[model samples]
Target chain A: MTVQQNVAQATPTINLPTINLQGNHACALGAVAAGCRFYAGYPITPSSEVAERLAKELPKVGGVFLQMEDEIASIAATLGASMGGVKAMTATSGPGFSLKQENLGYGMKAEIPCVVVNVMRGGPSTGMPTRPAQGDLMQARWGTHGDHPVVALTPGSVEEIYQQTARAFALSEKLRIPVIVLFDESLGHLEETITLPDVTEYENTIRKWATGKPEDYKPYKADADGVPPMARPGDGYRVHTTGLIVAEGGFPTQKADVVAPVMKRLLDKIEINNDLVESFEDIDCQDAEVVVVALGIVGRSAKKAVRELRQQGIKAGLFRPITLWPFPTKSFRALTKKAKYFVVAEMNAGQLILEIGAAKVDKQSVSGLNRYDGEPISPSLIKQAVKEVLGHE
Target chain B: MTTSNKKNLEMRFSGAGGQGLQLCAKIFSKALIGEGYHVSMSQSYEPTSRGGLSRADIVASGDTPDYPLTTELDVLLILDQAAVNASEGIIRDDATVIIDPRRTKNPPQGNFKVIALPLSETAIKLGSERITNVVATGVIAALSHDIPLDIVEGALKSISPKKFLALNMDALHAGVELARGLKTA
Candidate 1:
């Protein structure tokens, strides 16, 4: 890593307000700031600290925290609590994320507004408990069975963890679907400075539970936004929860007509609002010949690597997806005219590259720069990758 | 190195895992932030407890960083022998490495100047088994030549528990003397 060769003391200013913070604390502060009132999760590495912090901190803010027996039960409890009329969340890593998949599908099926925080560990199955991995990009998007709505946000920094975890909850409640805050194990365990925001700058989502006239209220009845009017259990409303297709009353029904609109509402909310759902970062690609697409810790490396390449006057730029699941296709795809070559760098064997490939039409120019040994891709390695794939190496 | 009236400075405490590196990083960063430096400290370590490497890159810069990536090393404090090898390759040539000479297997060899302080052994001399980091922080503060004595003292003041305050203060000052005694060879 040639420090003097690149990145002179430029863009000097207050960087972001340094405050020593552990990643777990960042997760807690993010969720709390984002309007999370309920947390239900089991303890696990890189992720346990999140739960541990929330256990100690949530009660002070009038929020409820529960330690469930297992990951499945933890998510289920969070789902139930969210529907009971408050913003809810759960945190976990690899094996636990796998356990929560069926229930995650249940969240989509039942349209429960809750946040699931998956601090990814290296895995096929419990591969590395503490090291980071961007391996769960596909899983966060399609881990659950069937067609389901998703709102997944990834934070590259500790500050982003605080900001995005809050956004995750707001997104879940606003869209009335399960939202996932995805951070690699690296980001989860890494500590850094985090500022507790001025409270007023952030907006939080407050779940509106059914009040008055339970008889007329339909739990699944769609409003103008296509989200069902949700009310909690014991709210004197006939609120029923289902994993099966059901009518607005919350009862399971075999009627095909009932299933279509339910599925439609589930999918449409995310689809119609795709523009609002995806988040990204773009640097110096205005007229670049090559664009490097990466996220998480790799995104940080890519940024430094691009800075190096640019110093050599190689016209390199970085495009990081803040929202990994929905894959910011619109923002990235729009740059095809200016970006003739796209180097997709990730810590996986082309998981995110597959999405980038699908989102591009110029197949010849779209290629992958991948690594999956759980070690982070360095700037030098990425620079070499950028040069090799684009014929500069 | 010259200061232009800036009261805050962020430095990174790096070493391999389980040498109490995270605790060391946290104590310093927390101490700095407590002294109002707006500190950002983070550690990245391999998952395993034994033989796995651990690194804490605690940044206590005066200005906040947009991202928590630290490239500038004012003082690179190291404990593990492997850490000396790792830091030697990457850290800035101008940066100072405060080493516990007793622990280093392959001491940094180059034109680079090193302030060798037996911080850990000194902590052992102070009757506690785990104040080498505190003593090292003192050494780093003294050798920093860039940071002020009051700021380092204030950081130590902010972090030490009330009962052990005087002892730590002595250890810290001891490190300063040790740093002053080192001659560039």
Candidate 2:
């Protein structure tokens, strides 16, 4: 609740006993604090520090850190570890994220709980490995093949990176699905001084495990929360998991009536628990004429630009979505109701802008300021873009 | 030459890869954090191992900055020509720029005070060229009033490898002497 309250305030809170910590290092520490016991990853630029720190830290906590052959094996081993009743995760950048898509999709269908971190970098394929970019916005949502559920959190600061990585584990365990922690390379590598939450006081969320008779156990069956209890390995329950559509009995099914409800439950679970999935930050959105929407580092830039614009008598505000996937549409609409125009600023060449356009209400104008040249969008650029949007009006 | 409030002060350490540019920023960050100032450090580099442009920037403030990356630099350290062009159009008019004349062919032409020091040469004379980053870190800390030399030395001792501690200390002191000479001249 303290972390959520800090994010809702949307201002950096400086507490005492602060240590200057890098974002990737914070994420690894966060995972350990969240009770993550297994890490399988191949080191990649921008995200390599996450694995590097985990390699050094995980063993101290009695966790297993594996250097896999490649990215695909990394996610597979992570999912396998989670299935063995351990909190597990794997981290990568763009190209490695591409290789893990198949196993990520498999984890989704099999209802395995795990965390996947993709520190965004410039890319169609290995594009500027060390440079920062937010080109993976849409890919994170639709990279896998099919209509699978996604819950991705984008934290904008080093402190938030630590908090959100822990939250990713909690959400994954609660929902029985893979959760992605998305942040740009700038945030991944940026170091800041802040107080981390005490690991002793932190509560770790454990996935629901099956307890009833093994004879009546159905691994694919949904409870009231639309999440079925997973059978722990070596339990007396007959559990079956596959990528194919399955019935409540946990066997493959092609019957329309059986497949329809199964698919519906898979997708509808996210919608049904939107309250748990939706999170965003609203800064000066009330009575504003223009709202700037961004995430990660661009969101931080927009925060500064919006404050400067307010001092200049411009009604500019920032609406940044910390929960990037599922887009947090309801809160975005509710918070920016007074805005007449919206500007979506991102490091990519217009991916999140499309989602913002789709979420707008009637008569609300939306524009985009896109950058894909491996440079971050600065505060001045966002201010200029907001002025241009207002100038046309 | 004068120490000011650490809030909102932007500093950059830039050069080719393998020059330990990020380490320079890390030392400053540790020193500042010890003084109770919040610091945010970010880096940019090419994919190569040792020859492309690399930079690490720090923004120190009373609280966490709204934007962490540098927009206007108060102090700039340039060790190679490859890093010169990347810093153009962003240096403050009153910024202090320290450059190695031996490595940089054409440094930026600006109103900022450009202090051309034999940074690399001084490190080589001390022991090895690899300690050039520690030497440059000392120059920036010595010139800036907000950072105390004792704190910087403490940070260096904590972060340096055990075998190189004495060499690094010598390089740091030589850098302080270089800046002291500039002030007296």
Candidate 3:
């Protein structure tokens, strides 16, 4: 279905009160609605508003909000909370995201279910704090180190930010992995009037809890879905969790034979359950000559540009991945089968385009429209690039 | 650059930082939301505590806009010269632009209608120069066909802090008078 139809179906027909909500604020609310009871974060630009809003909203719901000393401690605290059997989250920008990598890696290796929000900003260091950039597209998937299961979502609008933030928590809990929600500073700060979904209507997905004999339980043992039931803190199940590779007994082991299946199960969980983990939006791609691939704010710009191009009788389409990590390759190829040319428009200097090139089935002509000076890619820029690629006036 | 049939009205409240440009846009956004129109507000500013280019834009439509950011402006409010160049090449031909002559030395020169008003001067006369944003908000509300004066006043009343309610109301009224005077002349 088209993006417009998806939006129409998502909006409830009932008369719901609409309010102007910033994207960051929507994330905080979404987390609260998703039954996230613990938040640990260090405030940074573009992403600070998420913590700020949660500081006010969490207390009302009897949730714990922490202003940790640093980003590392922030993620560490968030992981600890989740291990204690609570849905937890922490938000940060580029510099802090770099600092939290080690703890984020720990969360991944230990299979701690938590949500990490990274509001993309211009960076290698503390580079342009207030400006927006998509430079972290590759880093988000690989920053935590090793061959680990990664789930990162990219939301384009404020409404999608809310929906995806909730989805991040659900996915993290269900799969027992750290789910990252990535959006640039532009979408983080943008406010729009939207009727938020009723929190009561959300079916919060709680993690599978350990049952039966406490002595017989093993922490790393996998079910048919490859996800092991987590032992609750007070449930008397003797559980051992660590950052090192471990066997089904949850004991650290370096023996290659024993570690092999343990590692494979960790990676196979996401791949086997791809149905629940993948989401994307395709707009007018059925009979198009050029298909533009983008996400986040750049995706919204491409959507507008594609609409304008179609008005001028240009057969242009847009394929936007709501789930950034894992790339949604299977669906992308299936949706854009007839397209001859592809353009990847992003705020950074060619990060996601690399994945697009690798994911394409044929040797279709692929080009990029990249802007890294911290300004967002506008619709006019995308339209001009599409025209140039198509050799049109 | 073709306009769609959708009533997508775009407006910008721009000036140097600490001028409450965001508050101006928020008040209008609240008013538009109350009128059953969907509003998308986005802002851009420097990383300083104060005194840099700051702008807040609002795009209102009957339905959620496909793109929320402002590409072509229908109305523009410039409180400082720092924000003048930011609107270049994007102002629509039939747009209404209001500027503070005391703060902006050279505004954009175009086919759009430019009304130079004493926005900051009016706020100074009231009490503080910080309320220049409120004054500008009033002028925009008065000149805009989509927003009514009473609804804008109600929004200002609801959003303004209790301590500054009376001053903000006075500033808003003075702004409406300035726009009305321009219309009469």
Candidate 4:
């Protein structure tokens, strides 16, 4: 059968009801709230609920949901759907995430805006299908193999996943890049009560479509803000997108002068507007002698540890980076200067600590509490890390 | 995490699969949430979960819980000996332990306040063997006082599938009555 037959046919609309949901389901509904009309994914554990829910629900919104043969094709079809003018997304776990990296890079280089949800599971290669881990921190940034900006957001609670997934779409569309929403299996399988936000709460952001005559269009042209307005394939605008470095006209170019501007614009779109993408939560850092840096579910445990330490009259704080890719360097640098030491706690051996050390000048000032045995980093472990960092009980 | 008399409660419900332990956990969690408590519930099944070990836990508190996983279980509700073994290292010394005496003839040794009831036998006598979990939840709600029986009933009314709603409610009420008798028994 031809690939054309693989596309899903639209079905009748169904009511979107508010209910207590798992983080994976919340991610699917959140994407729908953010105007995702196309979902192409291959089911992977812990992340499978996202694909399963979208398959049944997308058609209700007059959207298309396609289950591809594999992870590579899943992302490819998603990119194709996005280029066809629909807001698209795909969800996967670690193994599938690794498969999608090449295309993730293609989506970045081609400036196709999309959202990729990684419901994180343990390990190198399908290590633990049902276990939770935050080992993909560096992989999300450097996984695609080259210097490219990545916008990765992690949500600790189910309710926060809804908000963050929607925000991921907004940031992807506004910046014309792929945004990754990381939810560990711990959060993905977690079921909790959440009050669904009204439509007004989540602000939607759509890319500026190219205007004027088709002949005047420069598909790779950068606006003053370094983001070029996008045009769909059938929108009467001649758009050329490729994995190769190209000029303003979107055709491949080998000349350094032409390549320099395109490369610079791609990086500048995110780095120059870093303020718009940087987000973090600071807890009790003012009087803290030691600050614990963490993200994902570890961040939640860290917050609890910080509060418990405070009750014991130990000055401890939590610095949680909601946006993982850009690193939240400037704000964390300022926050670090006030604290005597930093403790980086995550499920992986030590991924985010490198960034924490890089953000602050001294490497010795930062320590790491790592767990890779397939369990979440507990609060007491973080409390111990804090005590060790402070060299006190 | 609260410093008041209103404190967080850590609970675990474990049984052989097909006893509806997952639904029991859900009903209890929803009841607590309805009463304005933040509850995080997680369930895990062994590789042989269909006929083997199935366990669910809930962390309920007036304040939002930072860690969803239960560390030191304040209450342990076991329907079989496997559950007692599963909960060996987790229960606090002062924890309130509830078990199905039919399955656990001789209870494990602990410094806990033990409430041994015929959970499965009671449900089987009520004309259904599928609702031992709901009955156990009723006993739990009554004993813990963190979630009210009426609230759990309301949660059941909303969440339980219509066909089995009546049977589940009956089992739940039977459990509530059983736990109430323990007050005087």
lDDT score at residue B58, model 1, on the 0-100 scale: 62
* DockQ-superior candidate, 2 or 3: 2
lDDT of 1 by residue, A68-88 (tens): 999999999998888777778
Q: Give the 10-residue window scoring lowest on summed lDDT in candidate 4 chain B.
A: B44-53
What is chain B's TM-score across the candidates, in the order shown?
0.76, 0.96, 0.96, 0.90
TM-score of each prediction: 0.87, 0.95, 0.96, 0.90
- Among all windows of 10 consecutive residues in model 3 chain A, the one with the lowest summed lDDT is A1-10
What are the RMSD figures for all models against the true structure? 5.2, 3.2, 2.2, 7.0
Model 3 spans > 4 angstroms off: A1-16, A198-203, B1-6
Tens-digit lDDT track for model 4 on A1-393? Answer: 000111011222245343568888889988998899999999988799999999889999999999999999999998888888788999999999999999999999998889999998889898877678998988999999777878898887887788788878778888889999997988998876666654332344688899989999999888887899998676799877789998899789999998887888888789876866888888876557898888878888887888888889988888888888888888777766678888999999999988887788554488889999877888989999899878785
Local distance difference test, each candidate: 0.74, 0.89, 0.90, 0.82
Give the best candidate by DockQ. Answer: 2
DockQ of 4: 0.48
> What lDDT score goes with residue A199 in model 2?
41
Model 3 C-alpha lDDT per residue in residues B63-165, reported as the tens digit of each score: 8887889999999999999999999989999999999999899989999989999999999999999999999988999999988899999999999999999
Distance (Å) between predicted and true CA of B123, model 4?
A: 4.0
Best of the two (1, 2) by DockQ: 2
Worst 10 residues of 1 chain A by lDDT: A1-10
How much does candidate 1 score in TM-score?
A: 0.87
lDDT of 4 at A327: 83
Candidate closest to the true structure, highest lDDT: 3
